[model samples]
Target: MFVVSAPSGAGKTSLCRELIDSIPDLRQSISFTTRNIRDGEQDGVDYFFTQTDSFQRMIAEQLLAEYAEVHGNYYGTSLETLNTAEAEGVDLLLDIDCQGAAQLKKNYRRGVFIFILPPDFAELKKRLYNRGTDHEDVIQRRLENAEQELLQAPWYDYLVINDDFQSAKKKLMAIITAERCRMSRTTYLLNNFTVKGDK
Candidate 1:
């Protein structure tokens, strides 16, 4: 499992998309959210949009692995989805905020935690403004929240700075490739090898 968190306008979604497209046997985990579906987002693809009652019920039933309220909307990862991925021996990529990432650190400690940071505050502010998706007030709030999120980068297993799009994508891909080769992650390969190191 891989958990990636970043501040707004850090290009995390774009990086994840590129990584998943190039890597086979890797799947992005679509989260469950109470927020309304945005333009160009599919229900099961981007997020499982749900009402507050259903989301609360899911929480009450202990169906979520990790959950958090961000920007007044609830978002969560389902335990069922994680179990399915594990059973099928498929890797998972999670694109979430720092709040949800912190919850994942405690509930899903085995995942590769990656933090994506903007190159600098000036660039970050520029990206946020150019995106024009949020209001000025909301953008300011996001900037403030981003400052706090960046401070949490030290707790992650890996940190990637998004200075250039292609370079950052390559770094993200490298992290995934290296992680897949870890002794703990590739234990199944040991089953095919003898004690003498012969297959």
Candidate 2:
């Protein structure tokens, strides 16, 4: 499992999409949320949109691997989905915030955690304002939250800077590739390649 956390407007979603599409045997874990489905978002596709009451019920029943409330909305990952992916030996990509990533690390120590950052604070703010969906007050709040989130970047296994979309994407792909070829994960292949020289 790989947990990716980034502040809003950091290009985390776009990077995750490219990573999942390029890597074999890797898929993004769709999270269930009680938040309203945004424009052009499809339920069960973008997210498993549910009511607050039902989301609370899932939490109470202990069906979620990790969950957190942010901005008055409940978001969580289903244990069943994650476990199934692990059983199939597929890498699970989690696009969550720092709060949820921290909680997940407590339980899933083997999971890889990656933090994505924007090129600079100026660019980050520009992207946020360009979105134009939030009011001035809301944008200010988000900026404050983003500053806090950036502080937690040192806690992640890797820090990726989105200076350029393509360059950042390649760097992320390299991280995943290197992880897949780690000694602990690919020991079987290493062992098979250790035979005495015949040629």
Candidate 3:
């Protein structure tokens, strides 16, 4: 599994979309959220929109691998989805916030953790304004939150600075490719090899 986290207005979402579309077998892990569905978002595709009661039940049942409350809404990843992906030998890409990513780290350490940063604070602020999805106060809050989230970058395995869209996309793709090609992960190939030297 690949867990990616970025501050608001950062390009992690767009970058992840590029990866899943271009790479066969790389599936996105659509999370469950209590937030209302936004324009252009589809249920079960972007997120599994649920009632707060149902979301609380998932937490009570321990069905969620990791969960967090962001912007007064609950977001979570289901352990069932993760288990099914692993059983099917398919990779999963998770686009979540730092809060959720931290919880996932304790539960699933094998995932590749990637942190996305904007080119600079000025650029981040500009992006937030251009998004026009949040209110002025909400945008300021996100800026404040971005400062805190940036501090968590060192904890991730990869730090990707999203200066240029295509460049950042290529870098993420490279990271995923390298992780998938790790010798330990591809040891299944050894089963087909007949070696002359024995350990």
Candidate 4:
């Protein structure tokens, strides 16, 4: 499993979409949330929209692998989703926030955690304002949250900065490719190439 996390307006979603589309066997784990759906967002697609009570119940039942409340709403990934992907030998890509990623890492030892950041604080602020989706107060809150999130970069397995879209995408793709090609996972290929007349 791979966890890709970043603050709002950091281009994580766009990068994730490109990664999923490009990778042949990658599956994105859809998260469930109690947050209200924003414009153009659909239930079961953007998120498995549910109520706070239901979310809490799932947590109590230990059905969720990790859960957290953000911006006054709850969000989590179901264990069933993770297990299904693992059973099928599919790479699971989780696009979650830093807190959720940390929670997942605690339980899943083999997960690859990648934290994406914007080019710089100035650019990050500009991107947030350009989105025009939040009021000044809300934007300020997001900026504050972003600063904290950025500080957690060292906790991730890899840190990717969105300085250039294509360059960052290439770096992300290379990382996934390199991981898949690890010696332990690709031993079969090595065995197939041995010389027939070898001792």
Write out the backbone clash pairs for model 3. Answer: none
Give the Å error, residue 29, model 2.
Answer: 0.6
Tens digits of per-residue lDDT for model 2 on 115-194? Answer: 99898899989999999988989889889999999888898999999989999999999989999888888778867677
Query: lDDT by residue for model 3 over 1-199, one digit each (tens)?
Result: 9999999888888889999998878899999999999899999999999999999999999999999998799999999989989999899999988888988888776889999989899999999999988899999999999988988888899999999999999999999989989987989888777675675
lDDT of 1 by residue, 1-199 (tens): 8999999899999999998899888899999999999899999999999999999999999999889897789999999989999999889999987877888888766889999988899999999999978899989998999989988889899999999999999988899899989998789898766666544
Per-model TM-score versus the true fold = 0.94, 0.94, 0.94, 0.93
Estimate candidate 1's RMSD in Å.
Answer: 2.0
- By TM-score, how accurate is candidate 3? 0.94
lDDT of each: 0.91, 0.91, 0.92, 0.90
Show how many residue pairs clash in every candidate, following the order shown.
0, 0, 0, 0
Please provide, for model 4 over 22-98, each residue's C-alpha lDDT reduced to its tens digit, 9 standing for 90 to 100.
Answer: 99889989999998899999998889999989999999999999988887899999999999998999999999988
Estimate candidate 3's alpha-carbon lDDT, on a 0 to 1 scale: 0.92
The TM-score of predicted model 4 comes to 0.93
